[model samples]
Target: MEETYLSAYVFKYGLEKALKKTGNIEEVTSRMIRDVSGGVRVEDDISPEGLIWIDGDNFNTWLKPKIGQCQADGSFKTVYQAAEHVAPDPYSIYPSSGKCTADGLVGADGKVRKNVI
Candidate 1:
C-alpha cells in the first residue's frame, strides 16, 4: 500500500473554504476528521500565531476586536461597543471630544486599569 499527503496549498485552500463556511477553521477541521472513517489526519504546520500575519495590514479591521484593553488584573476590555460610535481617527493624539479613545490607558508599570471608560 502507498500513502499520499495533501499539499500545503491544497490544504490551505480547503481550510479557507471551511473557514468561510463555518467561520472557524480549527473547529471545522477537527469535525471533518471526526466524521471520516479512517480518522484522516491533517498536519497544521501553519503556526496559529502566524495566521494573523497572513493578510497583514489588510486584516487590521478584522483583528481589531481581538485586540483589547488589558486591565490591571490582566483582564481585557472590549475596545469598541456595538452601540457606541467608533472614532474616525482613532490614532490621532488629539481626537475629537466625542470619539472613543482607541488606545487603552496603561499605568506607569505597564498595567492596564479597569476604569478605562
Candidate 2:
C-alpha cells in the first residue's frame, strides 16, 4: 500500500537494480555481521579478505587444526563465486571414534548446558 524506496527504485530503475545491493564485499559483510552476542560485539573488522571455504571433510574434530578467516570479499566477481556459502559434508564417517559420545548438534541431548568438568 505504501510506496517505499524499493518500489520507487523498481519503477524508476527496474527490478534487478532495486533488488540488488551494490558494495565492496568486505564492507558489505562487515555491515551484515554487526551485532552483539552474549557480552561480545561480533562485528567484523573491515578488511579485504573474502569468504573462503576450507575443505575439512575428513577431520576428526570440528575445528581441530584451525580454519578459514573468511570474508565476502569477491562474490560479485563471477557467477561461480556463489559457491562460497555452500558447505561440504560436515560429518566424519566415524562419529563415535575421535571424541566423546556427544552428537555434534547443539542441545542434542535435550540439555541446554553441557558442563565441562
Candidate 3:
C-alpha cells in the first residue's frame, strides 16, 4: 500500500536526520538513503497483483484477531495490543541467527533502567 511506503519513507527520513546528530553525517545519511532506496525499488518491482496475494495472506494471518468482533453495526474494539514497541538501534545493527536474537540494541524505558550487576 502507498500509505505503508509513505510511512516508511517518513520514518527513515526522520531517523537518518536524527542519526546525523551523532556524527558521521555524510556516511550515515548516504548509507540510509541507499538502503532505503534499494528497499523501495525492490518493493516497487513487485507486481501490483502480487501484492494482492501477499497482503491478503498477511492480513488473514496477522490481523484476523482485530476483526473478530465485527458486528452488524460495523463496530469493533481492539482486542489485542502489543505490550512493547521494539525498534532496532541503528548504531548496532547486525544480522543474527534464525532464533530472532538481537545484540542488546533494543531500548525500552523499563529495560533501560535495569542493571544486571
Count of backbone clashes, every candidate in sequence: 0, 3, 0
Error of 3 at 34 (Å): 11
- Residue range 1-117, candidate 3, lDDT tens digits: 744754454446545654655556545554454333322211234432112111111111111112245668886555664443223223333322111112222344323322322
Which pairs, if any, clash in model 2? 50-71, 50-73, 51-71
Where does candidate 3 stray beyond 4 Å?
1-19, 22-26, 29-68, 79-97, 102-117
Candidate 1 stretches with Cα past 4 Å from truth are 1-6, 30-117
Candidate 2, superposed: residue stretches over 4 Å from native: 1-45, 51-82, 86-105
lDDT by residue for model 2 over 8-92, one digit each (tens)? 3223332223234443433333223221111111112311233222222221111112244445883233213342344334323
Clashing pairs in 3: none
| Pairs with backbone N, CA or C atoms under 3 Å apart (clashes), candidate 1 | none
How do these models rank on lDDT, best leading?
Answer: 1, 3, 2
Worst 10 contiguous positions by lDDT, candidate 1:
52-61
Best by lDDT: 1
All candidates: TM-score:
0.21, 0.19, 0.25
* Highest-TM-score candidate: 3
Q: Could you tell me which 10 consecutive residues in candidate 3 have the lowest summed lDDT?
A: 54-63
- Candidate 2 has its poorest 10 consecutive residues by lDDT at 35-44
RMSD of each: 19.0, 17.2, 14.1
